[model samples]
Target chain A: MEAFITYTLFAMLVATALAAVQLNRLFAVVMLSGVFSLLSAVLFVVLDAPDVAFTEAAVGAGISTVLMLGTLALTSRTEKSSSRSSAIPLLVVIVTGIVLVYGTLDMPNFGSANTPANTHIAAQFIEKTPHQIDVPNIVTAILASYRGYDTLGEVVVVFTAGIGVLLLIGRLGRRGERQKQIGRGE
Target chain B: MFVVAAIAVIVAMLLVLVRLYAGPTLYDRVLAVNVFGTHTVLLIGVVGFLTGRPDFLDIALLYALINFVGTIAVLKYFRYRAIGDVSASSVKREKAR
Candidate 1:
């Protein structure tokens, strides 16, 4: 029964993602993307990671979809694929997929109890985290304590991306204004 | 069973990638990329379960948050730029008249 539920959730995730891609209208695509996120949140619940599920439900289904819609309204709705060729991006994607597949070939069997991942720092932290951090959730303990620096770095990256976007758009605005003024003077 | 599910998710991810590659507008590409990001979050969670390392859910959560913020920033950029373009074009129209 549990296996059935897990499989169902997984199927939903795939279906929603495919819908996001197959849809032509940008609005529909973004909405389907939210559905995908919700499906993933359910999958996380099935996997016993309530915290992760909560974040996915909130960020993925909630905020991300909203932001993408905002972007859609500001930009063109349908992609103009007729003008350009699809060769370059296709090649890049294929190479990336091939490399990832090759890397996965050497990975331990799925759910194997004795995999190297289970024997390394991950296992040690999972075992000792509750005692050291007094957190019931071992994942939270490791994220907030042992590997906190990585999370900080991730936040910094977000900050950088935000600043980058601001600069890009800011410059575009100034350029547009200058162009307008020149048109008026002429 | 989980393996089959993983395959389905991977196929979906491929479809999203195709959309990203073939997307006609920048907005379409961004939409597909957002979908891709969400799938990645799910993929991480499911793979962690499949690999028997539930702890990796932490990273997935972090990813979900960051992806949200990144999407918002991009959207904000688009909005700001679009308004500027519209005003500039209007000014051009007046000058031409």
Candidate 2:
């Protein structure tokens, strides 16, 4: 059953990604990217990594879509067609895909009990989390408490991004003027 | 049962992806994205139940909120060329009406 679900989602994900790559319409590409993210989030959940799935769902499907649309507003709606063939980029993608598939061959089966991911530090964290953090969700416990510094760093990175976007867009000046014009338009 | 449900959601997702890729209009892709987001929420909820990890519901809820905000932002950007003026524009439209 799990295998069936996994295969189906993976196939759809690949199809969407390939379609996104072939598309000339930037809007369609952006939307397909959002679809790609959501599918991966589902795949993450099927693989028993709900925390990762959650982050992917929120960041990938949510924030990235908004950010992309913002970028689209500043750019062309459709891709600017180039006279050059996509052969080189296609070759690079095929080579990278082959290497990645080769690398995955040695990885343990997903959800196997004795896989390194399940047996290594994961066991210790899962074992100690119940007592140390007293959280029902070990993933959250590990992320919020045990790995506090890492999470803080992530927050800092996001903060920097917010500041950078505001500076680049000059929201206070441009957005304010636009808002006034829009207000008068009515 | 969870497996079957997941499969169903994935199939629906594939159908949405087809429309997203063949979009004749921008709205079609946006609509596809919205539908895909809803499927992801359902898939997460079902998968969580299958794995006996109800705690993931919180994450699913978060996805729901984020998805809503994302769709709104995208639509706003498309219409106004800016997300920040959503409220101002809506208010103006109401006054004009």
Candidate 3:
């Protein structure tokens, strides 16, 4: 049943992604991408990674959709017709996708216990998290304590991105004034 | 039983995605996305029970909150062309005078 759910969700995700790519309306594309993110988040849960799913749900479906819409509001609603040929891009994408699939051929099966990821520090983290961090949730303990610096780096990156966005698009209040001044000078 | 519920939710989500992909109007797409978000929250809860870790409910709750806020932001953007205060433009016009 779990495998069934996983496969179904994966199929739906691919379909939605294809639809998003084929759509020319920017608004529909943004909305379809939101659907894509939601589908992938559910897939994450099925794959037993709720924490990653949480971030994907919040950032992908929530923040990115809004950001894309904001961009659309400032730009064109429909995609412009491009004169450039798509043949090279399609060939490149297919080649890259084939290579990616080939790369995944060597990975261990999903949920395999003896896989390096499950055999390595993951076991130690699971074993020691309770005694060392005294946290009920091992994932949280590992993220907040064991991998403290990594979490801090993630936070710093998010902060920097927020600041950059603000610097670029946070001038709404001043923009009106600037336009008025230009009108007066003219 | 939980698997059954999860499967049902996934089917519903598939239907919602169809609407989201094929909706004739922007509002239809927005509504479809909102419904899809709701289905995700339900699926999360069901899968949490199915997997025997009810703690996933916390993530579902957070998802619900963010989904609501995002839908409102999109609707507001469509209605006013901005997500901030609707009166900001009027205030700017007054200041320009």
Candidate 4:
């Protein structure tokens, strides 16, 4: 039953991704990406990583969608048809995908307890989280305490991204006036 | 029972994806995405119960809130061509004049 649910979710995810790729309308593509994010979030849940799922849903489905729409507003609604041939890119993508699948072929089976990931620091973190962090959620404990520096780096990355977006598209005081001038010129 | 509920939600999600993919208008795609988000929230909750970790409900609740805000943001963007403030654009226009 669990396998059935997982397989269905993954299949839907692929379908949404393919649709997003095929669509030329920017609005529909944005919407499809949002659907893709939501589907992946559900997949994370099925994989027993609710914390990752939560972040994916909030950041992927929510904030990124809004940001993309904002970008869409500044750009054209439909994608321009490129005169360049797609053969090379398609070949590159297929080769990269094949390499990725080949790499994964040697990995342990899903949910195998004896896998290196499950047996490595994961066990130690799970064992010590309660005693050290005293947090009920081990995932949170590890993210916040055990890997505090990594989390801090993640936060800094997000802050830098926000600042970059603000600098780029955010209406600085004079820019708004300039935009109005452009509007008037049009 | 939890598995049954999860399966149902997944099936509904598939239908929503179809609408999101094939919707004739932008509004249909928006609606389909919104409905898909909702289904995701439900699936998270159901899967939490299936796995015997009810704590996952918090994630579901968070997803529901984010989904609502995202839908509102999309609709606002469609209506005003901006998600921030409509009055700001008006003020700019007036200043331009």
Candidate 5:
């Protein structure tokens, strides 16, 4: 049943991605990208990665969609027709997809207890987390304590992104001040 | 059990994606994106139950809050070219900054 859900969600994700590429309206493309993000967050939840799912939903479906629309506000809503042929890009994408699939062929089966990922590191974390942190939730313990540095890094990245957006767009509420500044940035 | 619900949501998402891809106007795409966000919130809640980790409800709640703010920002930016548009009276307040 789990495999069925995973396969079904993955198939829909691919279909959405392909349709996003084929679409010409920039507005639609932005919206489709949000759909793709939301779908991936769902897939992550199905895969038992709620932390990842949370972050994906927050950044991908929420913030990224807003950012894309901000970009559209500055640029043309209609995608410009490219006189160049798309065949090369299409071929490249297909080749990359094939390579990715072939690479996944050798990976351990999902949720197998004997998988290296489950054996080498995860086992230690699971066992030690209870004793070390005494946290009821293992995932939270690992993220907040054992993997503290990595989580901190992610926080810093998010902080920097907010800063970058502010610098680029300034405060939107200061519209009059911005207008006095000549407003050609868009 | 949860698989059935997840499948239904996935199907709905795909149908919304069709509207997003064939959008004749900006509003259509925005609506599609909004619906997709709501579906995602549902998917998270259901998947959390299926996986037996009900604590994941926090994630769904967070998604809902952020999704609302993001959608408002998108619409505001699209309409006024700024998320927090300053009004005539508010313009006087800017001098304090």
Candidate 6:
């Protein structure tokens, strides 16, 4: 059963990746990228990294897609044929793919309870968190406490992005002649 | 069950990608992306369950909020641009002081 599930997720990841590459419309590409992110989040869950899975889902599928779509709306929808050349990006992709696959070769087996990841910090958290935090979810305790600083950094980063987008959109709002008129009149 | 669903979602995503590729208009692409985003939110939740880590729910919630905000913002920006374009040439014909 587990094998079937793993295979299915792996297939989903591959399909979404293909979809992301195949889509030409900028919006569609962004959306497909969201799908790819969600699938990756699911894969994280299946791999027993719920915290990472959550982060993937939120940042990957959510905010990133939003940002991409915002950029798309501000730009051209149809992809420029000239921009689709299979030159440097393809070479980079191939090299990165090879490197990634090679790196995966040495990783622990899926769902192995005794994997190094499960034994180290995770075990410590699982064993000690309940007594410390009185929370049923050890992962929560770890996120809100054990690695609280990282989470705080993430929040700050998100805040910065929001500010950046606001600045960008806000500036666009003020550049028109009407805006200039209002500015002059006021 | 979760895996099966994951496969189904992925297949759907692929089909959506094809639609994106064939999109004749920007709106169609945006719609496809919106759909993709929703699916991803669900996928994350499911993944959390599969991995025995419920803390991921917080992240999923954050994603949902951000995705909605982003889509609205994009749509608004386009509308604003369209409005700006129209007003740019209209010249506000009036005799008011």
Candidate 1, A37-108: lDDT as tens digits: 766776776666767777777777766766566556446787655667879998998999999999999999
Off by over 4 Å in 5: A127-186, B1-7, B50-53, B84-97
Number of the candidate with higher lDDT, 1 or 3: 3
Between candidates 3 and 4, the DockQ winner: 4
TM-score of each: 0.54, 0.76, 0.83, 0.85, 0.76, 0.62
User: Which lDDT tens digits does candidate 4 get at residues A32-59?
Assistant: 8888888888889888887788789888
Tens-digit lDDT string for candidate 6 (A1-186): 445556766786787677667656565676667767766776676666766876776677666766675566456876877746788888998999999999999988766878878779777877888898898987688789888999999899989988998898756655744576887794
Interface RMSD of each: 9.7, 1.5, 1.1, 1.0, 1.8, 4.2
For A31-134, candidate 2 gives per-residue lDDT tens digits of: 88888888888788778787788778888888788788777776678888799998999899899999999999999876578887777888899788888999
Ranking by TM-score: 4, 3, 2, 5, 6, 1
- TM-scores of chain B, in order: 0.80, 0.83, 0.86, 0.87, 0.81, 0.76
How accurate is chain B of model 2, given as a TM-score from 0 to 1?
0.83
- Going through the candidates in order, their DockQ values are 0.07, 0.68, 0.71, 0.77, 0.58, 0.34
lDDT of 1: 0.69
Clashing pairs in 2: none
> For model 4, what TM-score is found for chain B?
0.87
lDDT of 5 by residue, B1-97 (tens): 8878877987887788777777777888888887878887887777777767778778788877877887788777665564444355444544554
**Looking at candidate 1, what is the lDDT of residue A174?**
68
Model 1 chain B worst lDDT window (10 residues) = B77-86
Cα deviation at A39, candidate 1, in Å, is: 1.7
Clashing pairs in 6: A31-B33
lDDT string, candidate 5, A17-131, tens digits: 8888788877777777887888888788878787788888887887788777766765678888889998999899899999999999999888889988777888888778878
Which ranges in model 3 have alpha carbons more than 4 Å from their true place?
A: A126-160, A171-177, A180-186, B1-4, B90-97
For model 5, report DockQ: 0.58
